[model samples]
Target chain A: MSETTILRTEQLKKSYEKGKYILNNFTFSIQKGEVVVIVGPSGCGKSTFLRCLNLLEPIDSGSIYLEEQLISAKDKNASKIREKIGMVFQSYDLFPHKTILDNLLLAPVKVQKRNKKEVEQEAEELNKKKIELDLEFRKEEFLSKTTIWWPETKGCNR
Target chain B: MRDMGISVLFQGNNFVRLLIGLLASLRIAAIAMALSVVFGVLVGMMMRSKHGWIRFLCRCYLEVVRIMPQLVLLFLVYFGAAKHLGIDMSGEVAAILVFTFWGAAEMGDLVRSSLISIPKHQYDSGYALGLTKWQVTVHIIIPQTVKRLLPSGVNLLTRMIKTTSLVVLIGVVEVVKVGKQIIDASRYTVPTSALWVYGAIFLLYFIICYPFSKLATSLERHRKEESV
Candidate 1:
């Protein structure tokens, strides 16, 4: 089976001020169900690139396509396009006023207008399974704990 | 019995007059504050408008109110408007109009600054969650802005209450005006009537304003604790 390209950006260009491009001629394509990591030094446009993908920051010039649809066009609905993309921030920006469950269900329930009861049930089941796995991993790690002799600590002056 | 300055408050119908006057002040302040807050929030939202002309217009209004004295504004509305524009505005109406204008400007500035102070990440996060701009503003931005706006709003209310004394100068017989009346009436009979009457007026203002000041302080402290 051939892999499908989910997202494709062509000759992307973005600048804060005139003639100063943060994302100059950037081009990339991501396949469906494939993990792509963006790594770069400080001041690089990693975050800006991600923001531009969702139209959080407007690109100066480029074409971004989600599958076959041209999403970066002027009249394209950014909010609807953003609904299909899920992003996790380095610093968790969860709504402080909402509970963890509500935070998880907010977009699905409110934006997608999904059935609340169904989403809630699924989320609860997922949370329970995650907690169970975490506990089992902790137990295994504890059971496999071993003591290592430190010859250097004993020989060195205290 | 000549130096009955403060004691004139207890004189015949003087106490009742002062109470009525204070009630009048409270009534005007309450109505003006409510209108100010409603109009102020609208103006504040306008100040953050994407349109440069809208922002410029709002900024001009804000600067005029903030730079000019409240007394001057009161005079402008009461004397200038009535004389030049041929509008028959009562003293109370003029006072309410001027204060609303002034208070709205102050409140608008407060709302603008508080809304601006919220981190950019909040909007980004809300957008990333697929919330529309209006939905993000209504659900996420407004709640936080309200929390931050409370202390300053309370402070502005208190300031408006205190500033209501300026209405007396415009011939509105509010608390200070009544106090002046009492002093004038007792000037010949009582030697220190002015002191007592003015002291009572001062106490009336302090009584009205002190609680609001305390409320503002507590609100600010509570916000700090929550943030920490």
Candidate 2:
């Protein structure tokens, strides 16, 4: 209930079959700038938990909050809440027909209704950063500590 | 009185006719394939959607497509819909509509399977990296699916090309129809010419489809090796 809570889930639960609770009464909260890892055994509901956070999986019962607004547990406004959250899969699910640059620019262009030139510029910037990170990795001393960091900075919201 | 030796392929007339027919078929297939690909990919994406009604609708469409044969689909498109529309569509237009529908269904399924087959971890990692769902689909899912789906798409394209011959049944002046015309005209001296004409048709089909088949198989094999 803190003012800085970026995400909050209360009594979250999911079940694939009737009465078979894979995730049960999971209550958790994430602060605005914190990174929380949900580690569990194989076949546990870690992935489901992530999906539920974004409404990718409908919660069987309970509710989730993003910022000051309620995300799930409501029928009408779920999609609107989902717009604020972004998800990426473990696999490099880049579109084959489209180039790497196009992949980066798609959501921004289509969903965000951003200018093509701006999106293209951002993609180019990311590409440059990736190259720099790679070069840093090759250096003898800096290789150990080099990190590319997030692809996009938070404040650059367009 | 002696009968004049009238060779059927006097000079180069037959080749010109066949060439034109081949080009027309190619044009029709190309346009149909392009439109179908666009439609199929969109449908495929919808099928993989999380919403209940969307998924159900897509599944229903796929099942219907699977149950109905493509030839029947062509008949419905040419005879049924064309008549109802009262536009008096050309046979070629009817052929395009039939194949486009068929290709869209098949390609949609291809795209859906490819999209679903991607590992969950991929989506998670993309999320962990803070990319949006749309971003992940466009970036991570679609690229991998394209690599997987290209060969099958090419295969579909070839099938579409071969199937264009069915348009002949509806009176399209394709290679087969022209060949049939030649056979009917030269019913006397063209004894066994049907064999040659059909053989030529098969060769033309092979010429169009062979490279695509090779590309599909080779790309598939290459993907496997790369994965391994």
In order, the B-chain TM-scores come to: 0.95, 0.91
DockQ score for candidate 2: 0.16
- Model 1: how many Å of interface RMSD? 0.9
Kindly report the root-mean-square deviation of model 2 from the true structure over all alpha carbons: 6.5
The residue-by-residue lDDT of candidate 1 on B1-228, one tens digit each, is 345456677889898999899999998999999999999999999999999999999999999998999999899899998899999889999999998999898999999999898888888878877789998898888988988999999999998998999999899989999988888888788868888878887888899899999999999999888777
Every model: iRMSD: 0.9, 5.6
The sequence of per-residue lDDT tens digits that candidate 2 reaches over residues A87-144 is 5443334444455566556555665677989868765665566665676446532221
Q: Which docking band does candidate 2 fall into?
A: incorrect
Give the range where candidate 1 chain B is weakest over 10 consecutive residues by summed lDDT. B1-10
lDDT of 1 by residue, A1-158 (tens): 22498888989999999999999888888888676777788668888888888788899998998886789999987788878875655455656656666766777777889898987887666555565455544643311110001000100000
Question: For model 2, how does the per-residue alpha-carbon lDDT over B2-104 read when each residue is reduced to its tens digit?
Answer: 3232344342487578768888788889999999999999988888788989989888887887798777877777788657876677888988887888788
Please tell me what DockQ candidate 1 reaches.
0.54
- For model 1, name the residue pairs that clash: B5-B192, B5-B196, B6-B196
Residue ranges of candidate 2 with Cα displaced over 4 Å: A1-158, B1-12, B51-56
